[model samples]
Target: MVSINDNFHCNGAYVAGDRTIKCWRYPRSHGSETFVQGVQNSCNPVFMAVAERLGADRFYDYMVKFGFTEKTGVDLNGEAVGIIHKKENIGPVELATMSFGQSFQITPLQLLRAASAVVNGGYLITPHFAVKTVDENGNTAKVFEYEKGEQVISEETSAIMRDILESVVSEGTGNKTYIPGYKIGGKTATSEKLPRRSGKYIASFMSFAPADEPQVMCLVLIDEPKGVYYGGTVAGPVMKELLSNILPYMGIERDAEGTEEIFTLMPDVNGMNLKDAEKILKQNGLDVQIRGQGETVYGQFPPADEKINAGTKAIIYIK
Candidate 1:
């Protein structure tokens, strides 16, 4: 929760109506805490200050800049755009409340998009579970294309944020979500819903891999879970499970000289960029067949992060 508050809480005043924008300041380490450790301990006031320093308008701009206000128009059913109350819609106390994920609501997809942007080099992307769209003739087309959804910050800023999130799992409140071998980066958020009055928490965990240059990302949310209700303890494990089941399924290599000696079948590379995806295949002594002119990699025939048999043709499409 401290990590959430540290990243989300803020206070500020703007020209009231401008959409164009901008945005920490962290917890002191007086206790047995280190850099991110202070924040990971869920030190309320510290994270609140971080959010306060970021201010509300800039944070709200980030929300829009990251595609939270729009529906993303994905093919998935029952999609909902995150609803954030703007300046006029909220004030000092309200904004501070929002700093820790209060006074706001976002769907699973919306949250995933925002978190993905942070881990994906500050580029917001349309989240899609399906691989591609197929025509009646069986000719396939890419479903979503990556086109710089929005540049929310400099690459440096994203790198810093990624490190802080990684610290959350390595040594902070979210330590429970840490996975061995894979350099997992993530943040935890636990917020109390309004009007319920009975005190229920919404737990969420967002994560990615190769922290430096994330290849894939994920978000998990657990509603009204019993006993311990925190982003780390509750949502972190779910996030871990998703990766445990999905990463091996994706066929990502574990050896240092990956694909050097043997070639494996491709799993799924639905959200990867073409150049990056192609590199993996080329190094594996495999071939690629691209079907479209899309610049963003939308889907892979054999898929990604998975292992495969020798001499497999890995088909990938970009937007």
Candidate 2:
């Protein structure tokens, strides 16, 4: 197991071969801190040190094992396999840059899939849109299954990663994505586009919910966003907004103590038959307050996509 407390000094710059890698906190040293602290700080030198320890061979092997060297075999066509330095061509500078996720290119999906393995009990899963097809009446028509590839890391290691990543959201650079009463694990990145010093970047944040037992993962990438382009600052809020609405819609209950608060999205019941609307509201664990005696719903309070606690009363206007 990799030591979370491995000591590293980040004086904001690391030199490898002819290249100089600088941390985001360049010109201001973080002095010395544990590996865990380095992750929290998003310190570049810590990762460069770790890469040095792993060496080129093992690091390149991990890149291949994580499906970085090939397409993820997704159902979609025209999927591209990202670029990675050839094993023999990876020198000290290459390894250092790659350690902090530069030097090579990877699709957002590829990064998500690899990140998933680190917290998903170490299983590499194929991402797909549908698990099964349903008939018009909602009867299961056919089932589709994707491969759960080999375990890349031990469950114990996955657990540790989960804890560390959770800290990233709760107390680190990804703090902007944190929501009260929910466990979140995430990483933030600001990737510089090609042409080196080009003033362009893709700010991104990758997150998963219920850090101890993840049920959903999200990757938000903002391409060449204007002003304040750091991932934690720009993309973190977007990720937070997304998960805030999505988690409750998916019926994932909040983990607050002394309370079991479950939430669901408000369905658009306007234009639905009164009885049908009532049924749908009831199914979503909402109590209905019908206004005016009529056969069809004309309006609804707490409108569609709003997150409401389960058993909450929904006011539906009829006509």
Q: RMSDs, each prediction?
A: 15.5, 7.8
Model 1 agreement with the true structure over 109-128: per-residue lDDT tens digits: 77777787777777777765
Predicted candidate 2 versus true structure: per-residue lDDT over 58-114, tens digit per residue: 999999888899887777989887999999999999999999999899988899989
Candidate 1, TM-score vs. the true structure? Answer: 0.63
Q: What TM-score does structure 2 among the candidates reach? A: 0.80
What is the alpha-carbon lDDT for the whole of candidate 2? 0.90
Cα lDDT over the full model 1: 0.67
Stretches > 4 Å off in candidate 2: 257-319
- Can you give the TM-score per candidate against the true fold? 0.63, 0.80
Best by lDDT: 2
